[model samples]
Target: MGNITKRGSRELEGDGAPSLVEGPRTELHTELYAAIMREDCTAIQVLLSSHPINQPVTILANSTSHRFLSTQTQSIMPIHLAAKYCKAQSLLCLLEHGADPEIRDSRGLTTLHLMLLHWPISSTMWTKLGNRTQRTLTNTQKDAVRCLLILCEHGAHVNARVDDSNKYSPLHLAVAHGTSPVLSILAQKGAQVNATNESSMTPLHMAAELLNQEMTEMLIACGANVNCAVSCTGSTALKLAVCTASSKAGRLLAAGVSCIHSLLTHGATVNAQDHEGQTAIHEACFGGREAIINLLLEYEANVNILTRNGESPIYMYLQHSSNLRDRVLLTKLLYCSYPLRLTNNQGALPAGIMLPEFHLLRETLIKLSQKLLSLEDICKRVISNIYGEKHKHHLKQLLPVKMWNSIYCHDSAYLLK
Candidate 1:
């Protein structure tokens, strides 16, 4: 400590505390701040031994950054600043010198929260968006992980939550922004995998919403509830995954698919209905995702599942008919008893999806809707439903291979074309 001008000429008071006779109340902690920043453990111990702990000080934030002149200074605890900047040695010193790791700053974020907020995210989070950035855990990230472990070791509450409106737990922040090492540290330290934020969104839900397969799998392995629904929409992790998949393509689309598979394999309800009575299959169909539709169907997703307006999955599928160049797929869905004659709350029928140029297609659909199902098709529907009722998601595993092939691999293209 180079005798910071404000801390000059410290004299011993009657109580033996360092009576600073020269500093403003606002800048009294300048020397202590310099000591912490310099990672001077001896000086830190000396200052903390005499001065009051948890002193709130105002200092310019982000002042050294090239982007701005200087940000408005806000009062923050020194422990938070240490953790936020990933001052690993300084943070350990602070905690060892009696700093409360669980104490919240003005933003209601604890030391663990700020540590996670500053940790570097890996490429795994952006691989879904087609970013192929090479992932090399930098020295800074290692320091962040070490800081997290130190905080945890020093009795930082792993489950402590932010007091703000988001009500984010340390685990939520970890999953939202932190790397795997940080998340692992928090999880091993007893962070709650199923903890929900103010939106009733769990860590797994946030992972699914971002279509982060790695985080999704990690949360599942930690015993995350695969079916936790959002408070406002009753949207489960599966539904949210379907929605994300519908909007993305290429690598991102595959990432969403992987996340959905992880959730479903971990026992997510394939047929979970939302507040509007929309299931995952309905969303898949509405998005015109052929692969997604097939996956949902194989998991025994109900093709005839209805929405609040009485619209079925096939109806949603037809809503994007331009994408369905293969009319045979429609015929196959009809064979699966997609309820071609069902009407919605507005009296919209399956044929309503047909365009004027598609006259032959419309006529074909109306005639098909009027005709009774052939015995083979009816048997396919009846037997499949019966088997699904008994086997549920395990239908493929339990059913005989030949029988499963016979039911799912019918040659309907020739009939439609």
Candidate 2:
């Protein structure tokens, strides 16, 4: 391998050398990079026909050739740039003209790596120009899959991970971006579906963390371990999904799909605990994900499951509730039968943890605790267990249609009623 040489600046020596980057072939390589960046396919074809196809092009964002010398300079091959910019025609033409598919850029990213990281800029670009429809977004995804197929056909390492920074395989990247098409492509091309990143997080863990139902399902179908945990924290994919979805700031879009439901459907342990001994239910409680909490409860999740720190799901719910008037959620916990008498590491009861303004909540729980369990209530609880537990497919066979609907279809808002 020829070293890129640079001169004059001591900083340049640490980054690039005088003899290589500033060499006589600089202008030709620069022009090639510009052509690829601009998606100039005609110029790319003409240039490749006249010179070496694997020529290294260094894009100097400023005066310096060494990337480390300045924030601007980046060393990339023609194919890597073409793949990143999603210049499908330019990418294919360069590949047809003999561009090496396996060339690593400054970040140790291959053309295949670029394809995995491909993003849709149509939303941003079209917003300024016009309006990009959903079809435009989908086409961007299809283009990425096409590029990946080309690289895989050229014998690109289908399971190659990012060499610099965190070791993220193409599968991990595909999961992180929630790109179902690339995921399918990678899996079909023999990519390791169970591949983990530097954190020992599998693609399922990543999909779970993003609350990406489609990707989570795909990875599971591809045989990704549903209960795969982070090596350091013992955090399962289900826990990660709950935590990620619950922690979102805006109107929780995560409530739309229950990753908890997906993982459990695939045989994930309902009470699987993380490094902190916190289950997915604990995470859902902490995030105030009422729908998820209900789903977990329906699966017979242990309501009193505690974290390593002695915090129960109820404790987490009370501690995390930003508004006490989030009463339906609070009451759902009560209805699910998490003990109000239970205390946390700080020795606070569920009521003791509440603010003064939440006296009504505290009073309601205390009053409910004193009420004798009636035969009707006992039967309803038993019926709920039979109708709503993990074997949901058996509901129609086990119960009358009206009873099943009454028990399963009702939301938390109907819990007190």
TM-scores of the models, in the given order?
0.79, 0.71
lDDT: worst 10-residue window of model 1: 61-70
- Model 1 scores a C-alpha lDDT of 0.73
- Model 2, range 144-234, lDDT digits (tens) per residue? 6677777788778988888976899988877776567677778888999888888888888888887778888888888788877789999
Backbone clash total, candidate 2? 6
Query: What TM-score does structure 1 among the candidates reach?
Result: 0.79
lDDT of each: 0.73, 0.71
1-417 per-residue lDDT for model 1 (tens digits): 122243233322333443443434434456566666667778878777656667654433333322312254455677886887777898988887788888887688888887888876554445544422433435556777788889889999999989999999887887777355666667788988898899989988888888888888888888788988888999999999898898888888888888888888889999999999999988887887767776777677888878898888877877775645657557666666534654678977655356676667666666766777667777777666555433544667867887777676667664344
State which candidate has the highest lDDT. Answer: 1
Q: List the pairs of residues colliding in candidate 1.
A: none
Which parts of model 2 are misplaced by more than 4 Å? 1-27, 30-53, 58-75, 88-99, 121-143, 248-251, 254-260, 308-310, 321-324, 338-340, 350-354, 358-417
